[model samples]
Target: MGAKMLAEAMGMKALLYANWERLELAEVPEPQPKTGEVLIRVGHVGICGSELECVVQRHPRRKPPLIMGHEFAGTVVALGEGVANLSVGQKVAVNPFVVCHTCRWCRLGKSNICERRQLMSMHRPGAFAEFVAVPAENCHPLPDHADTRLGAMVEPVANAVHAVRLTGQVLPKRVVVFGAGPIGLVCAQVAKAMGAGFVVVVEIAPERLAVARQFADAVINPAETDFLTEVQALTDGEGFDLALDAVGRSQTRRMAVDAVHPTGVAVWVGLHDDETSLSGMGIVYGEKRVQGSYAYTDDDFAMALQLVVGGRVEVASWVQEFPLDEGVEVFWQLARGEARHIVKALLRP
Candidate 1:
């Protein structure tokens, strides 16, 4: 056998998406880093809501027979040829969004919307495995005192930072966030950290609501009370200065628009639904502004790291860690919505 074939014979454990709604622990060939890339031994990898959605919904973009994990931190074990900046045994967080720098959006510093953007789990092999090879530039160094497991959260926090930064509210007072999932919880905390006087989180799940209380100023169960009415009462009928929808359902999207005052900003960061219906006349008449937040920019990612390292964001209170071998069972639990108490789940490989 040739040298490459010999390497392919050596395998590593991974959580492989064999088919829709099926995650299996399988041994796969370890990856080799190409030029300008580095091979990393994953320390901890987060299971994002989007990955669960892809499995339950069988998303077309994320096909089967894939390794699906993007939020992760690991140590560089091997560097590819032509790589110079990174060294072996260095701890770092992975920014899963890879973009072509020549694209117009990239040139404009909007690499998230680059014409040729590729996400780790979707466009290439991801960090669910024992080893993942990523572009050298995509790795962000972690501080000596930083916990490697917390590094996995940097990507998601960067997402929250990007969403909140888009609102342009320097000191928003009366901010309401919809949903108490990882992104929503983080969004509420980010808003508060950014000087929001009052931050309320709306969630229907009691378990999630219980967790939200730690990060949000107030927690509301909309199923028990009227959502808009409570919003009006909370803001004294003026509505919130900024409203964020981390749940992409039609109702939450509409509520985000309705919950914000005229001239207030509503930022949508969820990807639950592709099509949503909203009151076009209400938006135009009320002069409300809406923005869609995708992934994060380099600056946003850096800020996320700062927030995490500086103790501005919470990590251990809600996130649960599981051995990589348990990923199959964890994936099933998350997909079935049975693990409501686990706001964020990470796999230690």
Candidate 2:
């Protein structure tokens, strides 16, 4: 039978991004795998902050009338032809970013920046439904001892892994991360895990700062304290060895650079605004390295899976679970900033 016929027989429901600020829950054809692909019965899908930007029409490349969930975990239900390694019923996580292996960037071993890369929800349908089909290579099997729900966390944590990895060798003795959201918190935890002597998190939200306190060496609220002064006090005026800005705003981006020592490294991981300004003279004089860390590399992805599977990182502390049917409401709530304490959200279809 065809895909539409199979979906009708199975009765699948999907949430589609119909238009800006508009999402519709509809019964759609269950996706069937083609050659070298596999069908996954989605167990959990993470709602990314970038998706929230999509809803508000802030993301430059995101177009409407598509399925939007990318970070997800599921069980393999069926394998397409030529796919022999992944067995049905195996738990897995989706990498979401599919690259054309023939691209120059791919040939250079920088597939994360492949010129022809296609991402789920950006170039193809995604896992915001009861079922999703992806290339067999995109599925990473989760360990039998790991929590399947945590599979949804791999992509996000992988982002942090890539960011921290960009900072180079010699782990910082004191690290300062701006923003206490999901990415910020993960960056702090990853720094601590990598043996950073001290990890400090800066945020304006009290609720988020409260959660930041759970894993960071110090959580400072810029709303209540003089942020630069406090950071100086914490580092004894020498400045942090490494600074990460996960917020990506002008002010926080400036803070990420300013809070670091003369030769310290600063990495920007968030994708909020297109334009930001900094002092070129200061950058030249201070000899600071400011780098932009994009999506994770293949090795970073595998390491992220290990991080989650080993229970070294706790995601439940920040995620708020919701049924797939509530995806529309969840998007609106997050867009309006009403879901305060929910640093991350997962949709279980």
Candidate 3:
């Protein structure tokens, strides 16, 4: 069916992952954006780390048979009549998290962690399908020179935005990022661009560690040695100034705590499956501050776009494009860890 016809069409198939068990394509009704919303013709949609957990029935947010995809970029094929500023035919990226604009946190310019949020892929139909209907306010115009594929990355890069800004230009400082996944590697590059003295990445996956070396000052595989001991020795026994736990497990989180200097800061960006414990004694004696980060805010997305525009964080090599039909196979392969060579994969429609 034509793009326009599909937008107006009453029925279509939305990919569903029933709480991490299995993903099945289902023929269902098409969705129309309400007033103040816009309908996009999805072109390039990417699978995320969270999606993997959702596929395996590990993530808490993956509801039964929900249309999944929060990372996407497409053209505004149709607009709900009440919407303004964005027009049909305009290319845009969808920042899927919708926060209440009137909250105190929002007023303080911290809406990404707002109390009330309506996020896509969790509460509503996501962009993995051909079309997505979202609030017009969530749409962002893409750079004229930017590829639709770049859309898949903006969400993750926003995290780098928070990472770079959180430390506030603590120059000549060393930074370590745990987990060589997309967010970790991207944050490493952002730290370098922001003028960190040294940036290191730690991961267990050899393949992902290789990619991390491409962008980080150093890459360490924890399996080969005691990563914490090595990190302290590498920093002359003082440790790094900033440590990030991009890997959500309790092990990585503890590693982050042990890898920082006495007064250094550690940021927790990973979502974990178990209750995590902090070394209270370490916090008191070490004076280490641990902060938690979540999805991007609008300001974070804006900063990420500028970084891409300035050629600070290159994402051209991070994307792996596949036909939409291969979505199931590709997802399964990624889950089994066979797709290590592919950093991020997009389902091209």
Best-matching candidate per lDDT: 1
Per-residue lDDT of 1-349 in model 1, one digit per residue for the tens? 9997997788999999988778899999999999999999999999999999889889999998999899999999999999999999999999999999998899999998989899999999999999999999999999989877889999999999999889774857889999999999889888878888999999999888998999888878989999888888888899998888999998899999999998888899998888889899889988999999998998899889889877898887889999999999998898898887788999999
Give candidate 1's whole-model lDDT.
0.91
lDDT of 2 by residue, 291-340 (tens): 99998877788888988888777787678889999988887899899989
Q: Write the per-residue lDDT of candidate 3 for residues 140-201, one digit (tens) a residue.
A: 89878887788667778888778667766564489999988888888888788788878989
How much is 238 displaced in model 2, in angstroms? Answer: 0.6
lDDT of 2: 0.88
Residue 298's lDDT in candidate 1:
81
Model 2 misplaced regions, further than 4 Å: 1-11, 58-60
Model 1 TM-score, all chains together: 0.96
State the TM-score for model 2: 0.96
Ordered by lDDT, highest first, the candidates read: 1, 2, 3
Q: Which 10 residues in a row give candidate 1 its minimum summed lDDT?
A: 164-173
lDDT of each: 0.91, 0.88, 0.81
Question: Which run of 10 residues does model 2 get worst, by summed lDDT?
Answer: 3-12
